[model samples]
Target: MIQNQHLFHIPVMGTGHSIDTPIRIAHLGINSVVSVVDDMLCEKIRQHYSSVHNIAYQNIPKSAADGRAERITAYLNLMADIVGQKFDELKKMSLLEGTEKDRYFRLLPESNPLRKSYDKIASLTNQAVRQNLIKEITGKMTLGSIDVNIMAKVDALKMGDDGQPLSSEYSDASSALRGYANSKLSSSLVLSAGFNPRLYSYLSEFKDFYRDKTGDIKKKIILKVSDFRSALIQGKFLAKKGLEVAEFRIESGLNCGGHAFASDGYLLPVLLNEFREKRNQLKETFQPMIQSFYESQGWEYPELSEEETTPKITVQGGIGNNGEMRRLLEEYGMDATGWGSPFLLVPEATCVDELTSKVLANAAEKDLYLSNVSPLGVPFNNVRGTGSEKYTRELVEKGKPGSKCPKGFLVSNTEFTEEPICTASAEYQLLKINSIQESDISDEEKENQKNRVMDKTCLCTNLGTGSMIRLGIMKPSYGRQAICPGPNIAWFNREYSLDEMVDHIYGRRESLVPKERPHMFAKELTMYVDYINELAILADPEDAEWKKLLRMKKNLDAGMELCMEIAKGSSYEGENLHSLQSTVEEQKLRLAEIFNLVPSEA
Candidate 1:
């Protein structure tokens, strides 16, 4: 009887492929299918659930003498009903959690019995795609070069505002991760590649293009515990992933770090338990790696802090039956951890609801043009708002070499590059700029009013309002298609967006786009640099104190950048690592010159 309740659900890719013309096929219909499924479950629950131990049990148990029997019966019924209904859900969720992909499970609709069961679900998802609920990708690699581009875009927006670059391309839009798209809409981001550093190497490409195009480089941090034997490793990994996501929030950037892992104790507990005699010897091997992230204040000096909320590990029960799994992840503490796949499986059941709909909406928006090209979907950095990337800025500069830029396009690299959105943005002239004053007209009283009719500008306050419709739900809508039109083709080659393609080809990314607020970032930075330069002129070049401060800033940037570059760089091996050190050293000297902090002794 319970077996008959078993229902299979087919998952469909949202990368839209044009069946004929504009009504591109896709996944926005997922909600309807889910609702249908939910309805069936509700009916089943009502029909099969015993009044004894279900929620019904609570009320009856108080009156019933032999409540135990009622509880047991209800519990059994609940378990059976859940098991049958959850078969596909659990299966999908499990696959999402692991690094492995069976492909067969992902393609359940192609078969007979499984296909029949999932037909309705599959058709709905397919309808969403066919309707262009999915956005498109350009197949552009975005990992390698990111920061420079983000920075460039940021700079371009300001310079354009101040007539530094093309005066027409000035957008003062700012964006935040887990935020809405309209207020501070963006089209790209640069960030740490993700947790599986050993697998992907695409960050450099993003870095170069993004910086060159002026996209934001979302920064991420990692803390890992290296003890392996105690099985605490999973916690460490989860911690790193969790913390990395937190760091993105901490830095006012779009949350993109989903791969940072904790490995601090990955090797310690294992060695301590298994090779007690050689524990000291093993330290020799891992110590160098750990010690390099030097903390003058202590082990928790900078990014490696035990003060953070450790990743709540769920895998220990099923990820690993042993006790030592989480301990191993803790050994190598990582701030940035993974959450994308987990969220994808049961977005409704996840604790990370803030960025879920934003990312999905963004992904759906970008999937339009990419449908003819891939199945991995596309990246949502644009709508998510590309972050503080050096290269992203460079890229923007490259695009709008004239000097002044536009306003709405500030946080977006797509406007400056070969993107899919066909928006005809007109740079406003002499924008009447002033923060909303709360004392007189705009206050708590106007909260709802402002959100209702307020023009979508580049302010965090306003953007949140705009995203109200887009967040928390992953279905694609008109907003998603603002940037790219999916395929003009089919599901086999369709990639809704670049981010999706990256995910499909590489995996969940670790990098995130930081916040983009409608403000003068480049102008502000330039002002600060000018003030420092003026101070440098006043102070003697050989002044030791000034040199120290400059050196200090350099050290800070070096450390921050190193973490970023290491996290950002595609190739973390040999010459690249050595080259990173040298690059930082060189930048340190440049900082000294900028601040007039040259070596006094010399």
Candidate 2:
């Protein structure tokens, strides 16, 4: 049902980096996600692109009712228009060398029948037959989905100026969903960062989410999950309301960019294996519930085939090369692979400014680490030497810390004030720091705690600053950009063209990473090892902590065993399969050190 010529998609980066990715590359038949978390960012991008495309633009002011949803809808509609125009033009272009049509087919996977057909047709000796076949092939061409993402947890309740909470419909996540639902774009809405009950319930209100009379879903749902159990749980909940999840996008908990949702030590390969084994259970469990809901509503449930009703299973997070991607498709049975962090370097695809782009390009493995910079209290993947890091530290040195809290999207704390405030806000930090100094604790411990408190940066605004800077909407001096790139970013040390990156994905080009780069599974194993090692060091696991740590240890051990089996099996080139064995053996030693420090569970 979710058919596309290409095998890979660009996952949502930060709130800003891939905000306008569809406008840039959807015409090329490559799917990409836009984060609708910050509607102001959407409005700004919409305004900028509207000018660039010479389209009439209208500003949706903040005071306007349903402004957030309006902003998102307007931006998405504009993108739909622009991408539609470009794709139509590309389809009409001649199949000459270096033309868009040539690039479009050339970018398809080697196994794609259309690409193979294009190659064979291009070699036809007869002009008339070739021309007719070309028309047929071009007619079959489809546009890449202009998908959007909603971080379900960022659904903060909005308040009116009269000091009363707005209706649940006006919440952050609800507004975003409303925006996408109201849009004219026929694409999927990816819900990431765990599930929200209210947001999930709101999906039932949109008629487009349901199967039409012709058994077509005008707009689909893609749940970005971390494990098989999560996929089953979330998928069933949506299905109970007659909402079908078109795809289950599995992302590595720790190996991904943005907020790292570390699982209970379940590694990527182990998770994938579970999904592979139990992928059928997802549809089997959801189908009946969906049918029941439709029947209760007195709506006809289309007699769709099983394949059409089945949810797609795709994987992302730290997918570095073609070999890993192929294994995910052939070995583990994924629908498609999502290449995320690598696209940060592809300017034609992502919107990263020059200053932040340089930092991402030259960053080494050591420079990229899991940081505590996110106000959501989640571990964020961060790089060193960014304008944001420098600015936050400088403010601390100057006796001023935290952001101005211009955008309160991440606000969830209400420790001192009646109204909630962001942890990265200046007022909250000042109050927290004063409270910490007044507490009865060791000087050294207080300093450490204060440093952690000061580390919370303005991700709500700063994440979008790079896009603003890149678009020339904001000056460099005003751009305190905060970028989140996964550890896989270290292997790529320079900018890449869209053609080069797409070619690399299909194995038409040579490996972009170093030969020493670890396999995605092996790399994920090391990160989990480091995570537990740090936890084992910090955790005073006298009772409950010991049990949690022990449970995590068991999961890690099981994952390592699976990795060993995979390493011993047949491998594709550039998979770095050997790294799995070595990494497992090496990490076993580290695990031993951690357990040595941690006492056995009672």
Candidate 3:
């Protein structure tokens, strides 16, 4: 019912207020991760944040070239551990100089042929970026026999800066709002990382570098292989991989939820429903390497035996997805529609409507919508930003706001609306809704095709600020019948919890909706049950829903004496009332015998 008791709730960020703390999903951009030398909140997130989830057109930690070989391998492993402790404190005070002097300071050689000529210029810049030549100016600038033992030991000593060097890129905005509050977020952030460029042009321009644009940004590139030196250089070579590209990004307009992110709701119709369900067992089992990136940069090649580009599809417009917004409104046929944050009213927000699926389904607990807007915390504090912004206003300055504000309205989410009842800790709520209506919002002037489909989702302004009080008692309890269909959603959207949908909103089960169609009353099921009981939160919400149903019936009746001390560890994944099963084992038949294969034992 209240979206099946909002799956145990937990989108934290505290400070008083818990009038039964509902939901208010905020954390949009915050000056693109806080700072790259505070270009003044990146000029107000590039002048009042326009959205494609705009992080002022992101490319986090910027300067690419694999961020110059990850800042020259972390500036030569901290200048080879501070020049092996200033060459063992300048040769234990004897101060060794000019070659032939050897025998003196031995602390320097952890096999340093100038660190193998900077690992042969980061392996020839990953072989000229796997050959698409990501602007490769030069190739092997020397590592031949390790530069004769690095110009005879850096011509006998002299490099400084022990704290290392290339220390620049910084931006944290509370670790990008705690990675958008771990989860329960929908107000924005899709990011996905990049740098694949056709496996960086098939291992450095060796041959098929997007084979004469037949590559299509090499399958909309998303080869994200985080660390361990880019997973031992590109996740052990794109690890077997599959699906080369289907990058769909649609929007031909309308998002903040009036719908229209089409191309079958993103993943480009699951990559054309998995290339028409694996076009004939993929050349007898797996070597596909697909490609397709056409912002209409001339669209020609389609012979496609199965590769030249059938599997290749880049089409990026911007998305939520609808076969990438009906394939760019049937390739430029266009109605344009958009309305970000339902033209702003904020309190549990909602409005969404690909045209059906009961959006905001009658926003029940009273159509939530709260962010009157405030967290003005981050703006500069970047110190390389990790552990998700552990709060470093130079290490924890608390109530930030050192500057910026004398120009316009800088405080809103209702001037810190308080109602704090306490039982608190990680308090935060930011509502959403209103995706586009009033006939897909048009203050027209002729730039037709619904003004290029309402210039794809009317660039952002999303709002949020929460401490709960059901977003101030459901923002005027559904009055103004006002727009708000879907903005900043968070009922744990993996499309309402992948199919199980908690046994279809708990009638014990039965609500995927088409059982020969009967469930009446619509307006998208009363705006999705008034945006889930106005984001009603109650997983022990300070008891009283009958003492929280007698403490969930005495904590599920000693839930197995709290699951028999869960193997003595007591809680987290264990203690399920003493039945224990999960040490954690979904499936990994040694993952095909760790790839050597042939291990299907079941």
Candidate 4:
């Protein structure tokens, strides 16, 4: 019952990982989600593709903006100009007579023998006109249907060169939402983010809100949820606002790439089951609230058919092969599966450097680990021996602590001075390192803390550098690149063409992914166990760390129980069931040992 033809989407990888990704995917008649974190890159891509394809250009609101409204406005204006020029070109082409029209069409193809002559003539004749037209509309028009990410809270806010607060535009979640709304882009824009009530309130202020002309709200916004509880809370909140969510993007807490938001122990299968079983129950719970809201607003509630109202449930994270893809869609009734990290291996799909791509392909389990690398303070998934890490360590050895703070996208804290700064800024690191040295912790602990601080590279800049470097657009002084791939990426041992990857997804052909890779459920459980064990080693017995450990233990127990239930059922068979049972038992023993170490309550 998946309404959309696209059975898969490429999640926003990073600033540069998937730059211009939509263009490549759209060329192949596939819809792909590309990141708009870098505005210039987005504008360039839009300009290039506006004439060729009408693909949805998605943006991630990961790092905060300095002048979000102006930036977005400028972006829309540029797109309008490009789209306008495309229309003009089409009109001109249409006016061509029989032979001329045929010649033009023939020359349009790259394989045409006289394409060079046609390009020369067109460039000479229309270059000035196109440039003037673009200049005229570059700051005036508005565009529709761009996607934006609203990551619940600001991880880092960009600062002005003068060190004064940039416009209130970049201040908080509300400002970001308002910036998009005021630009008249809200109507067509898809607001995506984790569930946040404050953000919901801001979005509700829009005249159209989530409604379409047909009375049913359009499926434009995406909610990133790990479990049903979160989805229910978000759904009810939207219903109360007379708004409707189009999709619930279920991501695996620990099994995904980039920032790993480890769930309390809810596995992907368990969460998907809840959504499938209670999908309509959830809609029923929200329908009344939605009707009440519409009534209060003196508006008639648009009664939606079941087809329009049923929320699309899609899952991402650690999904590798055609088997897993088919199971998630057919067995679990998922609308689409997101293939993220694997897309990094397809040069046609992502902007990874040759060296970085090879490193990712050759990576093993040990190379990938959750580390305190992001300045956002999230548990980011990082690979070892990247240029970023090596450069960071070299800087630490040379008495420097942090990155150059080039692009201040991740700069939100002002802990070290009156001006807000990034935790990964050199100034902040020097001050923090000094303070940590004076703390009461052991020398070893202090050293470990310092290493953690230094480990944070300027991900904002480093992540974007891969594409620029690969395209020969910019060369960095560091001469190294950083890559963030989920542990699932380790199982993909070779580069893949986009067709091969797509084939793999639809069971046409299997490539890149290894046959012996463990089931995603087992991998996630093992990762959680490892994460808890690491926390235990660093956690003081009397601190809140103990409580965190307790929560993790509870989640692991829940996950184990769920796995056991699945093993006993008909969902899995043979090797899959054996792997599930064995992994659960192994994790259970490890959990028991950790639980025994916990001090009894008084």
Q: What tens digits encode model 3's per-residue C-alpha lDDT throughout 1-602?
A: 00111111111111111111121111100000011112122222222222312323322243342332232223222222332343334323321233311211121122333223333443454654533331221121110000000000001111124533222221122112222222221121111222333323333222222234333331122221111122223322332332332212222111123222211111222232343344334333323222123222343433345443322122221122222223323433222212122112222222111111122332332233321112232111011111112221222133321222221112222322342111101111111111222235464523232222211110011111111112332232222111223322222122343113222322234333322221111111222222223223322345355343333223222332322233244222111212222211111222222223354531
Q: What C-alpha RMSD separates each model from the true structure?
A: 22.7, 1.7, 25.6, 10.1
Off by over 4 Å in 1: 1-332, 335-579, 599-602
The weakest ten consecutive residues by lDDT in model 3 span: 144-153
Supply candidate 3's per-residue lDDT for 255. Answer: 18
Model 3, position 523, has a per-residue lDDT of 18
Per-residue C-alpha lDDT of model 1 across residues 329-357, encoded as one tens digit per residue: 33223221222221222223211223333
TM-score of 3: 0.21
Off by over 4 Å in 2: 597-602
Tell me the TM-score of each prediction against the true structure.
0.25, 0.98, 0.21, 0.79
Identify the superior model by lDDT, candidate 1 or candidate 4.
4
For all candidates in order, the CA lDDT equals: 0.24, 0.91, 0.23, 0.67
| Residue lDDT tens for model 2, 1-602 | 33567888999999999998988888888998999999999999999999999999999999988999999999999999999999999998988467988888888887888888889986899999988988988988888898999999998899998989999999999999999999998999999998898899998898999999999998999999988888888988888899999999999999998999999999988888899999889888999999999999999998888889899999989989888889999999999999999999999999999999999999999999999999999999999999899889989999999989987899999999988899999999999999999999999999999999999999998899999999999999985899999999999999999999988888888989988899999989999989888777778878787788889989998999999999999998788999989999888888878787432321
Better of 3 and 4 by TM-score: 4
lDDT of 4 by residue, 1-602 (tens): 11233567777687678655643443222344544445554444444454445555544343434445545544544434443444344334431244422232332223323333434444545767744543433222221123445456552443566776554335555555555555533222333446556667767877655555566443256788878898888888888887777778889898888888877767777788888898887778877887788789788766678867677788899887766776788788998888889888989778888778878988899999998888888788888878788888888899987988876667767777876678888988999999999999999999988888887888867887777777666664545577779998888888887667766766555445555677777888988888888888878879997888888788677778888886676642212556678888888888777666433210
Q: Judged by lDDT against the true structure, how good is candidate 3?
A: 0.23
Judged by lDDT, which candidate is best? 2
